[model samples]
Target: MKPSKHTKNQENSRRNFIKHAAVAAAGFMIVPRHVLGGKGYLAPSDRLQVAGIGVGGKGQSDIASFAKTGKADIAFLCDVDDRRAANSIRNFPRAKYYKDYREMLDKEHRHIDAVSVSTPDHNHAVQTMAAMQLGKHVYVQKPLTHDIYEARKLTEAAQRYKVVTQMGNQGASGDGVRQLQEWLDDGQIGKVETVYCWTDRPLWPQGISWPEPAAQIPKELDWNLWLGTARDLRYVEKLVPFNWRGWWEFGTGALGDMGCHLVEPPFRILDLQYPKDVQCSVGSVYVDEFKRGYFPESCPPSSHVVMTYAKTKKTKGDLTLHWMDGGIKPERPAELEANERFGDNGVLFIGTRGKMICDVYGSNPRLLPTSRTAQARTKKTIERVPGGAEGHYGQWVEGCLAGYGKMKMSSPFEIAGPLTETLLIANLAIRGFDIREARADGKGYSYPGRDLKMIWDSQNIRVTNFEAANQYIKREYRQGWTLGV
Candidate 1:
């Protein structure tokens, strides 16, 4: 039977009201919760309307995690690659989809309270900055931005915008870091003076020249939009959906890929900040025994970067951090059994009195001598996140509901920023190692940057010792993109 006249009228009225609301909201930014609820009236049950950019791979998983909290409604999805976003579109059938983030943000700003940025590293700062400028809280992926300048600006922007923000380093919210913090407070490993973080990453290709004979851009992807802040270039096979991590123009290699997850613990536990100095050595890419491949656009096959930080209140003297990637590992601690597993990724902290080790996210923390771990330890000081590291999504969602500064965060930009900048500083050393100058004899190139230590002027955001290295601190953005105000 057909609907009655009254029911049909009510349905028509609802559609008209929604259309009118959209038109009216087009002129204004969405007001945040704290503004609407004022003080002391917000409820724990408040749901956040979240929009996702780059809704594929990690981006798809991130939105799924948010929805898992039962407190977030995935209202919008944006991605340039249709194939990559297929999963999210299927998962959130009710959500609106867009190919351009700027269009999504502009049309749906009033309906979205937060934005999750899981795009390529190059696009992170610009995308997240746009969302924040609209008064929308943000959850950006790890390593935050592609450049040191972008990281610093985003950190300051967080304060300027007074918005709730969390980095994608879920390990920051993990139980591992908290337990390690407790052990440190209890003096389980004494005073940490050195940190070693290593990862077997790039699991994709690196240290190779850009593929020749540009491949056709896939029909499923919009190439120009995917380029984002990076200069437009011919589409190459294997660069999309992943593998971009090895290219300097896009991904940040191993450091940007895993530094936030592994280095964050040390940053917090040691109260470390911008490194005063950085140096590095990288594994050369080789085609044969006679000659080495030189691909400046690609990250090295492996690297060992060392950074020095001045003493913080938490340290008795200067501290050193050693980061190794491309499957490089530090020497095994004497305390660990020869047969024991060192894990594919791990962090080792050497304190004055003893040492401690943990896997990624500071998980499975153990003191040196293995037996020592069974001994008495520090009492827990930092309150554990409700669901541990997995709670990362909920914490950000809840914090957005609580408004700016009203909720505590494990890796807010204020914290992740410096940590990321520290990693990017190490990146400078690694990239500098590849800097080549022509030899007078014309036999080949001489790398003057090799073995030089870059002394960083953190306040100035530039390297004092190496003028050439300073150029990378704030790289030029592509013509159409700007880090939003």
Candidate 2:
């Protein structure tokens, strides 16, 4: 858990900068903010200085949202691809740009008060951990980390470093989730027994083989940096900007992409924690009429994962949660009329008394009977975020300013870590579905992972029933890359 040499140098640089800043400010007379620039004017030092990693697409909006808070200054931006970073660079013309996050942290850590990580799944742990080690508050995008081990480490680091931390699952801050929680608390849905969360994701290709003849690397991209923590591989066309979600090496498939948003409600309302066991069945692809294609390098086309969690205080008994992706959905509840539509992506909570459903991000929650939705009334006991989901960014900025443990954040590492681990644990079952071994007779193959249930030892962070599935828990980093803990 010792800091790396580079981290140590950054810490020293931060100290020196603070010392010089104080000495330089000694010559200036203290003046009221109103005298300097009229009323309600904030001095530069009053704003939170933020450095954004992977500043493109979601990253662009994430940093922009923070800046919109008027309490944070976008001071730096980092991305492996210049093309993706272009919009962010133009939007925050005053922000310094860097291709490597390590370089940004080394040279600019002294100036950054917070870091926003909107990178690929594989790089989230390292990048976020780096910022946290420098005592910079962090807001990382959803799923937290690519692996359960990484997720656990980041969770522990947040507590160890005592820095304000928030995960990018904005739904945790939405009003819909609070309403759902209030309903459950009021026993509107008495003693939940089962939950189903589904998403029509993986719009990108999956269950397919890797592209043959690697495509030419784009001039604007640094392929090595983009592949940080993942195995070194040649660039393939259509993999940048998006589509990486389909591949196991660079992305985490549909579950990782959408699970945080959809599963978060049940996780919060039910007070669920680590799953006891998981089993899954996946849709397959065929290369021809005779052979079913086996592409272990890619995620399955579709999957249905079932996980069992011991009952929490709110539940009457053990709870079963089903997660389906790639356009699959659960059976509709009979309470709905034939004309009613079940959402393409939604969550269903079945309780002893009734059922409730909601769209992604816990939005538009309604009781199953539909008629009951309007009639149902519950106390507004749970506090709501100022602007609901849109307030997620400003909440984090304010929390950082309030300092650790001073203010509450909707999806801090304490909650996001375990939620992410649960999804990744389910993925172990999905990925294990294809672990094939050559038959001893050398005639065919034996798929031991098929039809098998993985028993997880949460404390140990491994699957006790299947050894092969544990490989995905923590991946070996590529050379020159480290999680730094």
Candidate 3:
């Protein structure tokens, strides 16, 4: 006899809870309730007050999207760098401006309803955590946290506080990703064993070298505040404002930057919970006058990281997901036909029955034989992935206002949290030590194998080889600027 819906739901919930518990214990820990409050909601009748931190690049784009909708008031604008924050300031003249986000939150907590964090990876957790603690909803840029530990905390905060949360992986809301899920559910790629995701990132915003020593710090910028929770380091122009993506301290290199967009479809379609093991074969690290004490290791700066996920009864046994970053990609699989080689960066799903391939936007996705038989089988089920409408930022605004909306948010902490954890670990792997090692805090992980293969205690979010990698997790916070829930 079939189980009742309630029983089935209970069983599913129990299993999912166990899975999350196992992952949390071994990976990272999050306490959202400590940060986000569950006392209120922004009703549809309410006009949402929004703040923005780090107002350049993607942040500017996010601001425009928010402006498109009438539901939100851009009330606060903050950024460590004055120049970068200028445009956004002008964009919202009615909004108050500040250089430090913490000050903005502390002073304006009573009035603000939500915040958008589009800063460097290192600053995301602190600012977002601060806002959530005051019961503010948050929309953070992709790859949510700089370290695995922050991801868990932010996830918990979002859940515990009941604040509306979204990650800026815009592609998450794309109709294409949803269709990718439908395809997987319908068994288009039978008995999936492997997934290959790649990207053309590090193209513009990537490949920057390490910083040198402290030079004359810019007057317009608050160098100390910029460092925030990171270790104290000399300021370098190349490492600031924009070029931080290539640095070890500020960015997660290529993987952390692009994995959320490139890898989301597979993770969603395959229903990825957590990988049993993660290993990386990174490229050479390079040097720049900008990269002296700032980054310790050099040579093989880029990498090809391979993450392995063991199966639950739901998955097809062990699955290997390979990720390439910083312009390095794996060679085309030998099994493909002559013309079937992949493009510069895309996804390839190899299952027992056949294969499926697509790009980040999920266009030109075609199955093998690339013709009628595949089309006949897939057409009835094939649906166009929604193009970005309402956009990610717009969607967040709607959600924040409690507008009756069903727009899918790509970077909801539920998805962004794990995605961030997986990508952040790649950085942990390359650093050869967890960022928190300098501290005796029970946070961070270690890779026992030289190849950077690690077995994580997901419940505690600790690495089995903590002795080696723990050093990279938490860094020395600048005085008066530490981040805590």
Worst 10 residues of 3 by lDDT: 291-300
Model 2 C-alpha lDDT per residue in residues 1-485, reported as the tens digit of each score: 99999999999999999999898787466675646888767777778999999999999999999999998999999999999999999999999999999999999999999999999888999999999999999999987999999999999999999999999999999999999998899999899999999999989999999988799899999999999999988898998878888888878899999999999999988999999999999999878999998999999999999999999988879999999999999998999999998989999999999999999999999987999999987879998999999999999999998899999999999999999999999999998989999999999999999999899999999999899999888899999999888
Candidates' lDDT values, in order?
0.89, 0.93, 0.71
Query: TM-scores for all candidates?
Result: 0.90, 0.93, 0.79
**Ranking of all candidate structures by their TM-score, best first:** 2, 1, 3
Root-mean-square deviation of candidate 3: 15.6
Task: Give lDDT tens digits, candidate 1, residues 1-485.
Answer: 99999999999999999999998897466566656778754443477999999899999999999999877899999999999999999999999999999999989998999999999999999999999899999999987999999999999999999999999999899888887878787777677788899999979999999998899889999999999888778899999978999999998999999999899988998888889898999998777999888999999999999999999765658998999998999998888898988888999989878888899887888878778778755676788899998899999998998899899998899998999899899999998888888899998889988989888999999988778887788878889889865
Displacement of the residue 427 alpha carbon in candidate 2, Å: 0.5
Tell me how candidate 1 scores on lDDT: 0.89
Kindly state the number of residue pairs that clash in model 3: 57
Off by over 4 Å in 1: 1-45
Clash numbers, per candidate: 2, 0, 57
Candidate 2 ranges beyond 4 A from true positions: 1-29, 32-39
lDDT of 3 by residue, 1-485 (tens): 98999999999999999999999886555444423435453343366788889887788778778876766778888877787878887888888888988788888898888899998888889889888888888999887988888898998988887788998887777666665565666776677888888876775344333445657887778988888776687786666766677666777767777788788777776777666666665443345565422234322345676777776432578888888766666666555578865777788788877777777655456665555225634443544323362466677877877732244455689888987787776666666622222324655433244555776666777667544676565565567764676
